[model samples]
Target: MSVLLEVQGVTKTFGGVVANQSVSIEVRAGEIAGLIGPNGSGKTTLFNSIVGAHAIDEGSIKFEGEEISTFRVPVIARKGMLRTFQQTRIYGEMTALENMRISAPEARVSALSLLGGFSSKTDTRGEELLEFVGLASKRFLRAGALSFGQQKLLEFAMALMSEPKLLLLDEPTAGINPTLINGLIDRLKQANKELGVTLLVIEHNMRVIMNLAERITCLAHGEVLASGTPDEVRNDPRVVDAYLGAG
Candidate 1:
């Protein structure tokens, strides 16, 4: 597969502390890639740089062959790339379907225009995605009322409303009930296979990432430590050492 996103020697520092130092990784098109690292290994820091949540100190980030390292979040998001947070993001007061409608890139609806803002087309697609994430019955329920797992599913559907070509998922299985994770994994696979959305997931759950991604990259101390398939990465002594040291 062709490379979809490339982060070459990227670095980021907060004040004087380096969060990522010479970190590099590549994610290919049409594949689910896993990014694994222990706490404070700069996993989320790298995601922020790639997704334009913050500026990188050095190096390059290219998506679909275009340099986007300097671009801001909205601009990058408009370019058919988007990301989901570990903590779910939704309008707590809004109903699930209402949140989905507003999530569309075209929505731009004001607080006063809530019910009248969405067109029938947006409504239909929103409902379909709600069903896709197994939230059809919760359509009219307030987003904040949903359980954490359900809220994450709602957030996933919201991201899909934009049809992102590449979706960066940060700790997708975190905070989710173990029983719900399998269903979440299935939805992620379905999104990749059926909707043609590529995924780059940052996960601490070893079992989940191992099962989800075709390839994996591991980072430690803000640098790339290993990169390969599930078995290869799992067997790398450097990777094992990093995790062990983290604990």
Candidate 2:
């Protein structure tokens, strides 16, 4: 698989504190990769830097071998990448279908375009994705009425509306009931295998990441500590020590 995203020697700081220090990692095309670490390990900071949420203090970020370190979020998103927050971001007042329609890049082309109409094709696709995420029955329901887990599913479908080539998900399984986790995992796998969307997932759930990701990268103190396949990362003494010591 070719490298889809690369972060080399990336660094970011706020005032005197360094949130990320020369951190580097890679995600390949057509694969689900996991980012794991204890709290304050700069996992989300790395994602923010890569997605142009903030300016990096140093190093480079490349998407499909093109330098995008200086690009802003909208530009990067237009290049077929987007991210979902740990807290679901949905329009509480809008129906799930309405949220999906507004999420398309075309709908966001301009402030005026938002008031303009959407095509039937977009509506059809929205329903398809809603069904894909098991929210078809709730398509017309207001987003705020859904449970937290359902809102996350709706957010996932919203991100898909843009047909992004790569999706960065931050702690996707957090704050969900254990019973629903398996179904969510299945949907994630389906999205990767059927929709051909590559995923870079930040997950604190050890078993979930171990089962979902093809490879895992672990961070410690804002730096790359270890990266490998699931078994390799799970058995690595450094990873064990980091988690244990954090405890």
Candidate 3:
């Protein structure tokens, strides 16, 4: 498969602290790539730089063969890329379906906040996506009232509403109940297989990452520690010492 996203020699700093230094990785089209690291390993910083949430001090970021290191978040997003947060970002007062509809690129952010209005087409697609994410029954509930896991499901559905080509997920299973994880994993794989979306997921749950990712990359102290197939990365001494065993 072709490379969908390429990040090379990237570095970032805040004040004098180096958050990421000379990091490099790639995500291929139609594959689930895992990113794992210990706390403060610069995993999130790398995601920020790739998605244009933060400016990198150096190196290149390419999506679908074009350099995007200089692009801002919206520009990158418009190019069919989107990122989900570790903490679900949904309007607390909005219903699950409402949250999904307003996330469309053409939807006016503030207008939706006040009116909660959506087109019939957007509503239909939103409802379908909600059902796909296992929240169809809760479509009428306010987002804030949902459990953390349910809120995350809603957030995932919202991102799907955009039909993103490359979706960057940050710690997707962090606080969710373990029992619900398999269901979420199945949804992610279905999205990748049926919808043809490329996923770059950051996850700490060893079992989840091991089973979900076709390839795995491990990071430590702001640098690439290991990268390969799931078993290869999982068995690497550096990875085990730095993250796996610790987890």
Residues 87-123, model 1: lDDT tens digits: 7888899999988988886753344555564589989
In terms of TM-score, the best-performing candidate is 2
lDDT by residue (tens digit), candidate 3, 95-191:
8877887787566344456465557888899999999998999999999999999999998989989889999999888898999999999999999
- How does model 1 score by TM-score? 0.94
Residue pair clashes in candidate 2: none
Lowest summed lDDT across 10 adjacent residues in model 1 is found at 108-117
CA lDDT, every model vs. true structure:
0.92, 0.93, 0.91
The lDDT, on a scale of 0 to 1, for candidate 2 is 0.93
The list of candidate 1 runs beyond 4 A from truth reads 108-117
What is candidate 2's lDDT per residue for 206-233, written digit by digit as tens?
9999999999999988888899999999
Question: Which segments of candidate 3 are over 4 A away from where they belong?
Answer: 108-117, 244-247
Backbone clashes, candidate 3: 0
User: Distance from true position, residue 145, model 2, in Å?
Assistant: 1.6
Q: lDDT of candidate 1?
A: 0.92
Model 3 lowest lDDT segment of ten: 108-117
Ranking by lDDT: 2, 1, 3
lDDT of 3 at 126: 90
